[model samples]
Target: MSQIVAAIDLRVVQLEKQGVTGMALANQMMGHMADLQMIYNTASDRDLRKLCQRFPGFGRYAMLMEEVSEQNQTMAMSGTHPYGDLPDLPEPLKTALVHVLRAAADLERDFQATADDGRGDNQGRLTTARWRWADDLEKLIYQFQSAELPLQTQALVQQIIKATAERIGRMG
Candidate 1:
């Protein structure tokens, strides 16, 4: 399983270096979805959490790839109506979401930049941003867990939180 994951990770890096993007990159990644899922499902919780800490950006990369693939499928199926409207989020939740999103964007931006190009220490910046993102996500999860949300929303949040907490735990 580790070898399979390593091969996929190497392939992704190679594709990125070759300038693959959008549907092409997502399509390539989609081929490894089953293997990735198997690894996630079969790995022990402690091992998975360690893996996440060791490769901080990998979870986000896999999620983005899967999302891109799903969006492409949706667009192909719906042609013009590719997405639906988002629900009206509660105020506190909305604010939390915004903060989390901004932190995630900052993390991604830092991840893309050179770690040390003589101007600044972007590796430290990236680490800070990653922790901020993780903290914000945990706060958001706590808010959802404590709020008087709709049953479906609460259930979905609980499901996601449970899976994530069990598999990868908290980064901070």
Candidate 2:
């Protein structure tokens, strides 16, 4: 007997190999990322500055997500993106991409929350700085939601995943 394959079947294949779905992977990835965040948040100003300077494009997607002008000279921009188009990625990658995006937003929110609770400088400067970054994160999240990529066709989802991979690869 012969078998039939569909677009969704690849997702199952990926699950069998990875042993974790998109959301779970997203959570795990974010957990690791959170550790980095803690380090960044705790290090001395000089060390933290160095870290930021070294890994400046840690969240380069935040710029594309926020739709910042690629040519803007003021904003510290990474080089041009190669993931300008989407490809036919497996379902697991697509779902994981969305969840990972959510994770990024969550981290941003976590930072914002700390500021809101007066955990930083009592003089409000630290809180203000946190808010400044938080607002940018929020805008990225909002942009994803507005794009409605999840509900769109598989092609669009693939495009996002491809773009994501490209940006991520460029990070290191």
Instruction: Provide TM-scores for the models.
Output: 0.40, 0.23
Model 1 bad stretches (over 4 Å): 1-87, 115-120, 155-172
lDDT of 2 by residue, 1-172 (tens): 0011111122223323456444443332332333344454566767645544544333222222224333333343453433333344456444445455444333333443444565654436434544554464445445555553534444554454344334333321
* lDDT, candidate 1, 57-99, per-residue tens: 3554566666866776787677653233325669878666555
Number of backbone clashes in candidate 1: 0
- Name the lDDT of candidate 2: 0.39
* Per-candidate RMSD, Å: 15.2, 18.9
Which model scores highest in TM-score?
1
